[model samples]
Target: MPITSYPFDGQDTTETQYSLLFRELQDTGIADTYGGPSFQVSATGAGMTLSVQPGFAILRGHAVSSTAVETVTLPDAGTSSRQDRVVLRLDPAANSIGLAVLQGPDIGQTQTDTGIYEMSLAIITVDANVTAIDAGKVFDERRYAGSHVGIWTTNLRPVHPRRGRLGCNTTTGRWEYWTGTAWTDLIPGTADNTTRWNGYTLTVSTSTPSGTPSPDRIWIQPTS
Candidate 1:
């Protein structure tokens, strides 16, 4: 007669008592095989969401939330500015995640030189085991100078005069004669300091010249 097979119910079936053992052995005839720990979740689903955490670390990296996208503002400094929004992604071949500025409103449109320019979310990689790395902290805008200006002068002598020379008053629009290297407030009307003969003509020189000197004459010119 053929053997009868019993149906499997919720009751314990150990009473039937037929032991079965299946083992996978290596070519060296070893019973134990080498294998890594099993994971319940796949590598693609391993990434976790993170928010604005202080200080960068292997576990807690900066990530962009759906509600809040990282933004950088640059004021007009008479040039174009730029802002990069880098995204971190897994690289299986490299065994480490990498950072790339993925999507944004025209990275090239950001001003290159401007007031209060910002570069937000530059990326940094951590390790292979980690799935994703977060964005870097926002760096404030730094001013770069394109041009500058400074005071310049052509006069080599001091503003104050000595001997019979007249001193220049930077405050008032008048030149006063120096009384022994010191400025005299008085304005001499007709005072002769020296006399000379020019082409058999008597020419008197005063502490202050009356009119513009000849082109070859040595005299200090007023400056702006």
Candidate 2:
């Protein structure tokens, strides 16, 4: 077994050592703020050019960042609509970081392969014979660390929340968790079986209420 340690006085550090350090600190993905978009990609509003805003990302444990806007010129579209992915790629063999495109089919979803340590930033759909790209043609696909406990509004939440994943629901202003079946409230008292509008006092009971509905009261029964 080979054991490695570093950072002593007058120590000589190499690229391998730095990569190991980065991999340990963060997972491979675009760095994101809680519930916020990361490494935004947008069309320059003309031509086939796109602009990737400055952002930090990790690929295969190697950290890469763009301090200024990076531009990419896409190839002309084919006869049919084509989906092209913009990726931040790290080629460990060449010790290089390249902004590249992965061409996709007109009918199927684009495949993102991690074997090459690439983090996809966006997907652009080019119509046949289209000369200009617009904001509507681009879709942002940047992903953050799965273990990250990010806060998100209902509309901005991840498309699929996995089991035991924790997130803050800005819409309800409550913490929620995925329980392998549904998103249940993390806080005690109110739960997944319950719903209320505008934080109105919701009275939960084992049986239905007998009296007429009160304008100020909301009643809900927990599922059997």
Candidate 3:
């Protein structure tokens, strides 16, 4: 005849705080089985230490402080068996527990468009001494009808009045000015220079023609 030992179940232990805690852990899948040791225990005088296996899944605990939580990510494993691991640490003083989660590559969609300055939106003003208005630095007539204008001033004297207009090039980033009839390059070349207009004056005169005249010629003046 063979003798068999029966499993022992505690009768005195009622389903109270400790039993409820254990059941909660078991229900959350943190523990392998009911009435079994769920967390590995380490001892310190200050507080208790609990460690759980990675695959055990969800965790629940009361935090004593805010800074008690700490999380760490694991290294990559391989193709078919990729191991995304997360670790949580709890601290007592801060009354908080740290949590971490792992995931795979992201999948989504995207779009794009290419557009340049199509209309004139602003007026750029430079000084007389400026040799050239580099591309994109000054405003042109086409740019005036667009959205915004940029002004580059380089004149030293406060009262000097020879300010120039900002012009644009159709092919590239270049600006020119209209001196009554001809278009003069305000700044030349690819390099942008100062748009300072200094010491230029405009004169205004009204004359009556033999017949009927058109409108009056308004001249702009610069202080000499």
Candidate 4:
């Protein structure tokens, strides 16, 4: 039989697989940093000066973690109020990553090109002949796009499960709560002990169960 699997020993991983892994872990967007939104965009002054707060983001398979605040200076406002977008761009050809402001009349329009990944941080409204860009003018457009925070499907559970980590088993169509031990069914009276994947036995309980980790474990497999 022909076997096509990812993340095997001595197997070279591709960017597409890395993207899938990242998507499985978290969504492609800004993650909370220091108990607040990461990569916050705000106006530094009235004269086209903008400030981006340090933050972290998972763009596709790439992880961007910035500790120093970045300053971006935009051009002077035009005669009419126009919309501009601040974005974090990823260029695969140049193998570089940087920030740029897409200034135009359209609102929330970001860069969309082949091999170039970009995400909008904020949308700022530049008024006609405005000298000051107030906080009200700068709208926070950061998207929290993590779908894997507390969600999982069959064969997609965390390899090293952590305490208080909750997930849903989509294969069984049930919200499974991982109580740092077994996969407990959050819905009342539902038993998932019969649910099996990759030949691994999973402990399912209808009621809340607490104990040490089970011997039966779910191993990671190809997600094709």
The candidate that achieves the highest lDDT relative to the unseen native structure: 2
Lowest summed-lDDT stretch of 10 residues in model 1?
21-30
User: Which ranges in model 4 have alpha carbons more than 4 Å from their true place?
Assistant: 1-3, 33-35, 107-114, 147-224
Which parts of model 3 have CA positions greater than 4 angstroms off? 1-17, 20-66, 76-81, 87-224
Worst 10 residues of 2 by lDDT: 106-115
Candidate 3 per-residue lDDT, tens place, 11-64, comes to 354323343354344322222222223221111112112122222222232211
Provide the global lDDT of candidate 3 against the true structure.
Answer: 0.29
> Scored by Cα lDDT, where does model 2 land?
0.76
What TM-score would each prediction reach against the true structure? 0.15, 0.62, 0.15, 0.60
Mind sharing the TM-score for model 4?
A: 0.60
lDDT tens digits by residue: candidate 2, 31-129: 654334457889998799999888777776777778888889888878898888888877766878778877776323223333356778888999998
lDDT of 1 by residue, 157-178 (tens): 3453333444445454345544
Candidate 4 residue lDDT tens string, 45-128: 657888898887877667778899998987788899888889888776776667889887754544443477888888888889
**Candidate achieving the largest TM-score:** 2
For every candidate structure, what is the RMSD over all alpha carbons to the true structure, in angstroms?
34.7, 9.0, 31.4, 14.9
